[model samples]
Target: MPLRTWQTTLCSFVIAGALVGAAGSATVTPALAQGPSAPADFTAIARERMPAVIAITARQRVRERETAPALPEDLPFREFFRRYFEERMDPREALGAGFVISPGGHVVTNDHVMGNAEEVQVVFGTSTRGPVRLVGRDPATDLAVLKVDPPPRMMVTAWGDSDAAEPGSWAIAIGSPFGLGGTVRVGVISAQSRDIRSGPYDDYLQTDALINRGNSGGPLFNARGEVIGVDTAIFSPIGGNVGIGFAVPSRVTRSVTDQLIRTGWVERGHIGVSLQELTPANAQALGRPNEMGVLVAAVEPGGPAARAGLRVGDIVTAFSGNPVESGRHLSRAVAAAKPGTEARITVFGDGRTKELA
Candidate 1:
């Protein structure tokens, strides 16, 4: 089967699973307790958010080598003939979803969706199509921004506070699923702060909303019809939605998109150090409580951490007065900090605690 057809079939087969998986063995908060009386109608929210949602098609040229066909060994004088072969240049199209974030034609979507494409087209509603220019992309967060010359008076969606989104709150996903544009799937935020091991910064919002192959870069809206997340990837062994979809939270999306728009790149603060999680045994050996903080294993020769006098075997307990719960917590804090800014770091070593600037 063709790749497109396989993807369509997978999405069709898993629609029911995506809808029903929310009822699985996961705890969800009651909707009435979330906000004002349960949203009387999701239809209204979908209608309001659909205009900002868009379908994106990216085209790329790929070179593929032809494979030799298998032949019976007894039938052939294969050695007497030379196979004439040449690589074929094939044009491939990838489908995804995005939303208009500004009236000036700034659109936001997953960077993977925009994957090194030679050309991109944005489709609004059903038929309004326009070519888009890649403004910026950040692969670390899997987010990208595109610019289009959209007609005046285009509808835009506002970014919601992803930090305010709690598990059990309603999550509505609008996007092109299997190339079917204007599709909406409703479910609840099953979990938050999900690290699917996708990247160094792995903070993702997990949802049971039906995010399939073509749903990448689509907006995941809260009950208020504000975009709280951008659907990115799904955890499925079968290449379909298994009720384990992950989205780049708006908190990260906003930070990345803002920087990308301004600088065309994300400048992350780096304190060069290799860190290891403080396991119970390591902590006990270090005469500290179990799993207290991250242990510094190595410091770069001339990096910020080394210049700040950070050394191997040092336990980083906190950063800028915030407690470091784990290696990930410390990494995230450092990455989010502005470069060139001085920060207070707390570390424990040599049977004593010291504060470093």
Candidate 2:
């Protein structure tokens, strides 16, 4: 029997466990220059924070042998032997990391880390480990939450408003990579609201911190020890952090995390419209010069865009207050908006510029 509606919808990924930081969290570890002085209380921070970070291991049951209806009663003996020889087997194992966010064993980590996991387990600071049950997950944001009954001593990290994290701010990352437990790396916020083309809402915080395969779902802390981002992906031609790593900003994570913990799902608004970036050639034809905007290629019938009189061949220059330079940006903006809320949009159509709601 399937689990109940809420239970069936819960997230299924594993948390942090024994991550081996190969290149670790730095894109390019500077070997030539002496690094800036370490933080004054680096030891204290690690000692105090490590306990909150927990390793997660997940296992999925793989059915090696599947049963098929036996052939007609007259099946040959040779074929019968072959069918009977097949062995039924089950294999289970997966691993990742997550940090304690709430006192009642609420943990946060990457969604992919737990997807397809049949059994999830969490290891606490005192070497005590236990199975964790999934609370909820959001693949669009690549985040998930798990609940465990951990000791009361689990350390917690405070969340900082990501809106205040500007470029060049100090960033520190902590997590297990490649089965290695508890490693730290430091860098600066290289950029913010960077869309890496990973998902519909790809608003990521770009950092120079070296994030390896095992860094997924870890926290990116501001110098004040506040959580600003959740480490997510890396842009490397070689599949390692080559100085270009991305994290889901706290703004996005906080919203998703709250929804997952409370409602077991994200309620995103959808304004159905297919869009494209305005190219130089297309812009010239449209009498636009040096203008950045997204061109509407198609609008779904009855969607918010269509209902609002949005049509093809129209160029969207802005949504709400943020500039829309590409379709991805517009998609994210629209999805983040409330379903019934009226949106302000700037558009160029039929040789006229207009503001429409």
Candidate 3:
């Protein structure tokens, strides 16, 4: 059967190269008791953290030949043409930056950097250095881990609590943009929980830092000199910084990076339901005064929502006690929920509020 127009109107979060600021207003930090806010000492922070920062280059392997097609014995074939293309151009090389996280040679970078890389190299500190090895990567969060056995005394960047980082707080970026290693840009946290449509868990810390091409997978630091975010993408049409950049929050990266280091990938709970935004017409049909909740267009058979008794045309007002304001909000909540655990969902159905497990 053809799906209804309302069902087709549903929107799932997709990767958009946008950095959404805080929902309403940006949150500012109070001035230090000593005096008015002072400029963050980027020099001091860079000095303490730059040694751990390393430049990463990913080399992709290009297969020069494929399986030869079988032909009839009578067909005239040209075997010389296949050998002629052997001296073709080499595969492209991708460049990005990473930082050492552990003493045992654990490093962190964006997964996209190592996505197609058959050979990975890690350059510690400045370019006047040796290479390292590629470990594991998590594409969902755009994080990768690399390992390099240095000459001992490897420096590391301390990770800050991303949950405590408020909007309007100072954010400093250090990365290799345009292949220039050890570059720095300064800005403020423009927003939080920004869904940049980059990945399923798209919660990003939006910043107004001057980020540009080649800065992907770099560190976003707070005034305390702790790493809070990883510079990944920017929102610009000209490919230059227009004072808007997005960083993967440490809250998300820490967990994903840890898992990637241990295992080879990160696992996310999936409910397999088609999520739709609550429109005025749909709300009216459900007897809602206004469009407020997310609608469940279709629940996967035997999936989490289906097992929880969620149904079509039901408006989910809350997920696991968190009030859901839109489809995007609800989707994030559900995606973050732990699998195999029952969650309470408040829904509006048949002109009445109902609770479903």
Q: Could you report the Cα RMSD, in angstroms, for every candidate shown?
A: 14.1, 13.6, 8.4
* Model 2 regions lying over 4 Å from their true place: 1-38, 63-92, 239-243
- The TM-score measured for candidate 1 stands at 0.86
Off by over 4 Å in 3: 1-36, 61-89, 127-133
Order the candidates by TM-score, highest first — what do you get?
Answer: 1, 3, 2
Please give, for residues 178-268, the per-residue lDDT of candidate 1 as tens digits: 8999999999999989888888999999999989977999999999999999999999898767899999999999999999889889988
Give the candidate number with the greatest lDDT: 1
TM-score of 2: 0.78
TM-score, per-candidate, Cα-based: 0.86, 0.78, 0.79
Q: Which ten residues in a row have the lowest lDDT in candidate 1?
A: 8-17
Clash counts for the predictions, in order: 0, 30, 5
Q: Sort all candidates by lDDT, best to worst.
A: 1, 2, 3
User: By TM-score, who's the top model here?
Assistant: 1
Model 2, span 225-302: residue lDDT tens? 788998888888976568998889998888888989988988776667788888899888876655699888998887
Model-by-model lDDT, in order? 0.83, 0.76, 0.75
Give me the displacement of residue 226 in model 3, in angstroms. 1.0
Better structure of 1 and 2 per TM-score: 1
